[model samples]
Target chain A: MNIHEYQAKELFEKYGVATPKGVAVKASAEYSTALGQINTANGIMVKSQIHAGGRGKGTFTNGFKGGVKFSPNKEKAIENATAMLGNTLVTAQTGPEGRKVQTIYFTEAANLGKRPDGRDDEYYLAILLDRATSRPVIVASTEGGVEIEQVAHSTPEKIFKVQVDPAVGLQPFQARQIAFALGLSGDLFKQCVTLVTRLYQLYWDKDCAMVEVNPLLVTKEGQLLALDAKVSFDDNALFRHPDIVALRDLNEEDAKEIEASKYGLSYIALDGNIACLVNGAGLAMSTMDIIQHFGGSPANFLDVGGGATKDQVSAAFKIILGDKNVKGILVNIFGGIMDCNVIATGIVEAVKETGLKLPLVVRLEGNNVQAGKATLAASGLTIVSGDTMADAAQKIVKLVNQK
Target chain B: MSILVKENTRVLVQGITGDFGARHARLSIEYGSQIVAGVTPGKGGQVFEHNGVKVPIFNTVAEAAKQTGATVSAIFVPPPFAADAILECVDADLDLAIAITEGIPVRDMVRAKRAMQGRRTRLIGPNCPGIVTPGRGEKSHGGCRIGIAPGYIHKRGKVGVVSRSGTLTYEAVWQLTCKGHGQSTCVGIGGDPVNGTSHLDVIKLFNEDPETEAIIMIGEIGGNAEVEAARWIKEHCKKPVAGFIAGATAPAGRRMGHAGAVIGGAEDTAAAKIKIFKECGISVAATPSDMADALLRIWKG
Candidate 1:
């Protein structure tokens, strides 16, 4: 899961990596604390806290200049924050609709540019999986603040890689090697070594899938700092790190998605009108595919897993209908380990409670399929049952188009 | 002989006391798999009896393999300890180990894969349906079910199937079986980004097997396995191959993801992979029934 910049910086401090002094403004009311407290002789960076990248290049839909703005005074900082709070920030990554900025990070902007020892030269640093090696790798570049993908694509030689052994871990010697590679000297080299080691430790200890420090900087004082922080933890490992999970912001997530997760259902809202409910992740995608192939667009991707209960199935229906864009529903279940009858009961339960308005097409296969079909049929509901996946997709498309 | 498993493949179960472990163990044995022993730490000397058949439980895979001389192990350990479970089987020196558990951390899988490199054991999945050889279910029966695949949907024949999905594999096999194109063996390589076996691994085994006439390869989005297999088939596969890719309609990127989900590699989307397969002289199936059609068109006049 992705955490905000403030949380990532907090982790950086906890792990011995230097970061610009920053405070998270929980709401527009708390702008005073964020603006007044941070010591920014260089300037204050009014950074809009969203989950996407390209924030510096992105503009707010509310006619703000940038998601991040460097201002000289507290008044300007609060003004930027006021413009950013609750406004939509559209980045290349955030798509056209954009993400609603719920919080803002007020950070001390640094004195950027070349120092006497070439220490102010910013460099890109990130630790992520090099899938080919099946190991964690550090990608470092002399060019910083630019997209690392662009750098890797343009000048391949400038990008340096250090593969950290999963079993042996990131060795101190390796960290030193990276420090030397970045062309650091003396105390700066040792400080970089410490920062690199600390970054590795945070990544390994936190079960983070990736830890990126864009524009990992060196101050005029020969100090190493992470100018930007983006770390995402593996969701599977989240159970072990409740402290990290607690950093999750509900405002940053889609309400429908959060509700679906509570019911143990995997659901992603889309721009279509036909809602898809299936058993496995693969099957769910295929169901969506056939729906599109049949000239219908899927409103969402919903997978209830192998052993979902009747209540979970009911919850899935409620969540699917929660979207006003949904014109029809398609339930395609191939119950191998899952029972079809249980799914059918859930469908029946959901319809009885919510009183279905939109047309729902049902296709049940595999174990206890007859019982499942019987349950739907006997419920006195207008659920359309198809013989095959293709038949069901076509039926849903026809039904939705008619509406 | 069929690839990977047959009637003589003695099996050992890891994490045998759990619901999935116990249920699948009973199903595998009943479907004629020679399940000799089970392992659940601290539950040693216990017996899980199903339908008049008792499976002896051991504390360690080492003990299970040693006492039973089991060459194959099926894993049902929970996600947290699953990699260690796989490591246990790998260290025990089993011929083939299939991990039936899902939700294992990718890092653990990477470490497990690293450890298994150049090892004697061949691992199948950490979240797969496992392998099944048709016509070896029992001493006299016609199937040897290793995973949770529905036994009713298979029949012994000349086609070898390898897939990354569970029930979708069943879907394809059912379509083939209904059309008189019985399978030799079907293996689910699991759907995770990092898994034990690849499509090429199973293809290599199927290519060498004389009993297999045609191969059916099932793949989905999110990985390079299917594309790699297409390359391998173009270069070395001796038999005709039929291909099907799930998730033709999978969203290109993650749902509000930050990183790690945005993969630049493997443009192995359904259309892309199908284009690759078609370019590599492999038949592509758009749907489950299309799989049967492809196999029949390749094998028959």
Candidate 2:
């Protein structure tokens, strides 16, 4: 559901919010044309569009190297872009594998003056789900272009929060209040308020999990602009908003996660050896915890969800077995609405179809549990059945160690 | 008398014509829930057979409630339509409504909660296994069967069982039954946020019930509802209570179980809740079997 910075900026721009004029280039030809389009003598900022933060560190582009430098020549921005395309860019923000460079955005760099009060003129504003309040809260701080979590921890008082009512939506007055709290006034402040309001509308309308505009910059000329933007939509709400779903860039995501989503299975790949397939979310986590507790690491956290049918379980099995790192499989179900026997049959069938060699441990409880165990027992695959969670974890750990 | 539902309670089914609705409707009737009427948006004036009872179907909850004098409503509407279904039952002045649908949007739940504010109607879950009372009757409005919990385990005893987990609740009930203990009432409050009731809310009712002796609480990771209830149990509630929280060492920031059953932050965890519950002098069960043993010890002592 997370979108790159350029995509978020495009959404902001569409809603009449002022953002730095930027061109997203994927090819050398497009990059050369972008250089002509910007025409700013002050030089342009070539930002590597990655989902992670802290792009300024040596992890990406050798720390930007003061202005922008091309490999062949500065004028051949297209050649430099071509060289950068499809390359993995490391950053303090990205993981060990490094985020792949999919699109490079060329934007006119901003030169904003310090505030009249001798502080940074910009501020960070993010709308995230506030579980405590059970609402989407707007988090704003005078500190711009930094992790909001750090600001929340270090200077909690400086962070201004407003819980938005989903029914009434974010009011213009609430946006104005936030703008004023960030020390804005007059037409520029009003413009900032208007932009924030629009962003809130976009957040709700698009069913976004988060809409963050870090460093809402106030230029030396007193113009307000969103210097950086990031938006993440709720994947569950994607069904209602097909347009946003279309904007998804699958190449930028974890391949395993993408594949799991295709099967309607929620899978988050982890660094472990045992691949877990559980019925409920709670049971899935419990299985993972018990696995870890028993000196075994879970390769992935996969929940087929509560109403999972045979095909979904079969597809989930394929996704789990597909991972080469998975040495063992643990299938746990506390079937309520879903039948355990159906899941057992699906797992057995999926193992046969996939020619799975991993050790399998299953504990099916609740509806049709006996039938489920009977089905697994009949399968030629070496399936281990445990009565309790502790027993299941113990058996799985033993099986994994035996391997 | 049982806590929320009994044999005399008239039941109205929302989304009754749907596949799940029809399936559970038949099972509930066989299990002894009063087969009053069913509500499906255009399926009024129709009757479905359950045992020997012929239950009439209506298009709306209001009309069904009026005709059958139904006191409890069991909703089987899809997730998107679940909130409205609960609201309709609330509007009809039904005493209790149990929603079986899962995956309702949190925003929709917020609205539903606001609508239910100041109303007498008690909502159970938009994503829960419905409540059950053993032989003297049961309400399985959700797609679950009440008969799954053996009638022998429930001896009309003073023990009250409340759980956020549906399947696990039945496991605990079955365990208690094996130990010659029957429940006064077993309520599955559900794990979803914006559910009909909380552990604290149900515990308060159980505390007031004369037939209820001890209580068994089953909670999961995600919300602070357990912490809130534990705080309440520490100060109020004179009876002994045993607690079990699922998912002790779930990874932080990863949602494991129910969409609402996620550990929202590091603190709102099963382990953290267990520690707090222990501090509150509540018997903590590490496993389902252990939960039953803890309850028995409390009851004996």
Candidate 3:
């Protein structure tokens, strides 16, 4: 659902919001060409295009200093791009394993306007759903180019929020309030109003979950430009927008997670030993918790949904086993609408199909639970049967630790 | 008496002709719910026959409510039109509208929720198991089963249950049933962020209900609805309350199956919510299996 900075800028331009022109390249050969396409007169910013924040402070696995580099010329730009592309970037957001930087973005570095006190005047603007109000809210602040959470915690007064009515949408007076709150006036104030209006329009029209422009810059030419763009679309509304769907980068996603989605399974990869397969999101999450509570860590969170057929179960097993960190597997089902017997038969067939070598624990409850448990018992497999969630978690932890 | 629904509450089915709607409608009727009318645009004057009971169908919710005197509606329309279906319920002025449809766009819900301001209808969920008030019968057959929850797991008693997830609600209900504890009513408020009801909303209803002696509130990581509910329970709720928050190990910024289960701010984590529950004097369940036991730890009945 998240798109890179370049793609977001493209959207900003489409919506008539000004941004520093940028080009994204996948190879070092295209790095110079990409830089040529942008206004690199002042300077070129080589940014690693991965789906995570804190790129400026990130380090490449190849001992490179920074994921995002400011190069004064084309030679240093290519050097920075070479160190980033095809290298893994470790940021505060991307876990210790890091995300592979597959694309490099080159953009023109804007000349930052200075305030009366000789400080760079940067501002922050973001549009997202305010859950408390159940409406779209525009968060604006005078402090920008830094973590907004930090600003919120340190100086709560500096932050200003304008909640828009979903029915009426962003009003002109509301846009003016944001501009005035950021201390804008004259032409710069007019530019801020236009930018805010266009961004809000893009957010609503594109069905974006969030649209954030950190360090919303004021250039020396009296223009407002979005320095950094981070946009994420609402996943449920993606069905209406095929153009947005094409922006999804499979390389940035976990392979097992992408594979699990194909089977209608919700899978999130984690770093642990025991793999958990459960019905329902909350149960799956608690399954992981109970595993850790019993002195074991879960390798992944996989929910086979309310109704899982035989092929989906088999596919889930294949996806779980795909993770090398998995030392054991736990199957927990609290069938309500779904029959436990069908789930049990699928588990039995999945175990036989994968020829699972790791220890397996199964817990079935709800409709036709006895027949489901009986199916698992008659499968002639070494599947540990658990009477409850607590018991199954303890069993799996003990089995994995014994190994 | 139940808080929202009972044995005598007449119900209508929206999108009754669809596969998911028809299936749960049949199940609700089989569980002895008084399903009086069906609403399918252009399918009016038709009768849906199932298990010796024939229910009349109508073209709109207004017609369905007027013709059948149905006060409650169970919506199973698809994602695209689910919002309009909710609006129809509001326009028809139904007493309660339970949206069983999943994958409704949040924007639609926001608009629908805004339009519903000052309205008379109380909406339950867009992606939920619906409400169930167990009746005094074999497998609770005479109970008002509004949504897709299995009726047999419930038992008519003094305990009230509220949760965000469907199967987890069933898990807690079954746990209580096995331990010889029955429930007055169980409500799933759904897992979406912009749902009609909140944990606090249901908790207040349960606290006010005289038949509800104890409460079990289940929540997950995401919004601050659970924390808000817990804070209210500390100052206002008189009954014993037990709480369990899922997604303790869920990574940040990942949607854990449910769209609303993602950890957003510093205050919405499972650990934070659990700590708040403890501070608010609500017994926290260590695991999902311990929901009933947690309540029993604080309350004898």
Q: Among these predicted structures, which one has the highest DockQ?
A: 3
Off by over 4 Å in 2: A54-84, A90-94, A116-118, A336-340, B136-161, B178-180, B191-196, B247-249, B261-264, B269-271, B287-290, B293-301
For the second chain, the TM-scores of the candidates in order are 0.93, 0.93, 0.99
Q: In candidate 1, how many Å is residue A111 off?
A: 1.4
Per TM-score, the best of the predicted structures is: 3
Candidate 2 chain A — worst ten consecutive residues by lDDT sum? Answer: A63-72
lDDT ranking, best first: 3, 1, 2
- Scoring each candidate complex against the real one, what DockQ results? 0.44, 0.36, 0.82
What level of docking quality does candidate 2 show? acceptable
lDDT at position A395, candidate 2? 90
The positional error of residue B53 in candidate 3, measured at the CA in angstroms, is 1.0
Q: Write the per-residue lDDT of candidate 3 for residues A42-113, one digit (tens) a residue.
A: 989989999999999998888897888999998888888888889999999998989998888899988989
Better of 1 and 2 by DockQ: 1
DockQ of 3: 0.82
Question: Candidate 2 chain B: minimum summed lDDT over ten consecutive residues — where?
Answer: B139-148
For candidate 1, write residues B80-149 as lDDT tens digits: 9999999998899999889988778878887899899889998998688899887733222546778787
True contacts kept of each: 0.34, 0.24, 0.73
Find the 10 residues in a row with the least total lDDT in model 3 chain B: B100-109
Q: Each model's RMSD to truth, in Å?
A: 2.9, 3.9, 1.1
Residue-level error in angstroms, candidate 2, position B204:
2.8
The digit string of per-residue lDDT tens for model 3 on B127-177 reads: 988999998898877999998899999999989999999889999999999
In candidate 2, the residue pairs with backbone N, CA or C atoms under 3 Å apart (3 or more residues apart, or in different chains) clash, namely A59-A90, A281-B256, A281-B257, A282-B257, B123-B196, B155-B182, B158-B213, B222-B262
Task: Sort by TM-score, best first.
Answer: 3, 1, 2
